[model samples]
Target: MELKFKFAIASDLHIALPETVWDHPSRFHLVEFSIPALEVVLSHLAQLNLDFLLLPGDLTQHGEPDNHMWLTARLRQLPYPVYVIPGNHDVPTVESMDCFAPYYRQFGYKNPSRLYYDCEVLPGVHLIGLNSNQFDADDGQIGWIDRVQLDWLESVLSRVSKDKLVLVMVHHNILEHMPGQASNPLSKRYMLDNADRLCQLLHQANVKLVFTGHLHVQDIAYSDRFDLYDITTGSLVSYPHPYRVLTYERDRDAERLSIESYRVEAIPEQPNLQHFSREWMGDRSHLFMLNLLTKPPLNLPSAIASNLTPHLRYFWANIADGDAEFSFPNFPTNAKKYFEAFSDRPPADNNAILRL
Candidate 1:
């Protein structure tokens, strides 16, 4: 039998009900619209007859008890199944994992005690959710799959047949969507610490597709070495406020996958939300851009960085709004080249259908 299905992914919902939102003077997330924006997306998704929905991570603003509670209740109301993983923000402390399972138990978990889960989302198709939040006091909030989970993943992959399609969902990125994600000091936070080990295992198992979030960029990174694709979605409450719809199909001789991305441009009260959000990001981009230049990989002096900040004001916002292309002709050649690389958008950056 041939298997085909459609699914949606909306990452980093950061759902903050009115009561849970905190005051932050320099906050980048417009989390107040978390609920409405999600509702808008869900309203559209609900009509699509999706086989399931995949919420990769950052399901709440700060993993507040109330926020988790709210998200669980809302998720229960959806018509289709939903699968989730805990992000660094979801479980602020390691102990919070204890309470995580009960909230999302109905979603798709054989054993709540183990944060990672695997289930057959469709015939000959599997969905695996792995928790990447490593909260060790010495290690801090790094992305890692501990030995126990790694072993569990190995056992699970070992049992699957060669014809089956394995779709892995993790909170952190396994591939470098940005420049120097693994080696760059500033970009390491967005990647899995021991990604090479996991990639080797997946490659051996013939796993092709992975859905991830947390960097809040609309990016798809493919590895020719492993023949793997890491598709990361943007935040629901940040600039571009995007989500994705993916359709997978298979037949006797061919397997095909299609990906299409969409953005939440407005809520009920804010019809021009896209315009407003971009401006908000631009207004606050000065310090962020300055830090980007002075940080590792660039390490420009404070004064030099400050002078160059204005020209690249919407640098990150553009990244968050994916398929970004950057070109600078006026600046010094080296500085211009260094900053422009961030906007590389190949043909497969946004949407495409591939034969597997």
Candidate 2:
């Protein structure tokens, strides 16, 4: 049997309405780059005749109700089905609002008011949706999969056959690139704090591939024991302006599951960070990501963050109109070393699929 579908993935669009809904000292402007950039990506995606659009998370800046409303209205106009989950910003950081449930109402399963939901994107392929954002009354927060969601997950997994293509979607990553994803002070402590528990759950069910955003850097993580891969894409508004498209198929006899990765190149004038470190080392705020070297796989810590921040902040202010890049040419070796270490997969003929 042959399974062929084309899908588009973009994250950290941080779409804003015409109004200035929220502000952070670090972000360029809510209404300026993100919304327009999303429009461009969506327009391009439509031309590709995509089967579906996987918006991993952060559909709006700060999870504003109006911004959420605006985005869905636009999504309704799209020609394909669009699936979404909430980024930390898509939920309220403040205790009162907790805006994520509303996003589920518009783009999630059965129109529920939870960030976690699932649906069938293809006849034999399943997309299990999840909501990873949760906070306590005392204002302490952790990215734990609550009991209700876990129950929901188990029930969904039970229905899948052993021979099926299952794509798990969520906003925060389970196995992040950096080691300190849970401990970093720079990221407002975003991540499924109990990601280990969630990983166990996925492993038990034989779920092998997960797609996530929110860290704003492109990297890959794999669980050797379970052979599960968690691939994170870079933000549209951040360095490299990266994105991805995946195509899955089985061998001629259908015993092996194979997948191919299409690394998104920046559109001629797309924006990329000379240093992903500079834009994210500190609390950049909701709608944008803190892609500091200190967080997760990089784990650069304070001294390095201090040193690199100077070089990074410049390009954020004035990236050129075309092919906006935030790379450090002066420090070539460091950059090369960074790329070699952080990538999810080594450079190869991407046209060939991996036998996962």
User: Number of the top candidate by lDDT?
Assistant: 1
lDDT digits (tens) for residues 215-259 of candidate 1: 988998888999988899999889889999999998888888899
Which whole-number lDDT from 0 to 100 does residue 253 have in model 1? 85
Query: C-alpha displacement of 22 in model 2, angstroms?
Result: 3.4
Clashes of 1: 0
Best by TM-score: 1
What TM-score would each prediction reach against the true structure?
A: 0.97, 0.74
- Candidate 2: tens digits of C-alpha lDDT, residues 161-182: 8666788987787875554455
Off by more than 4 A, model 1: none
Candidate 2 regions exceeding 4 Å error are 28-31, 93-106, 179-188, 253-352
Clashes per model (N, Cα, C within 3 A):
0, 15
Instruction: Give the lowest summed-lDDT range of ten residues in model 2.
Output: 316-325
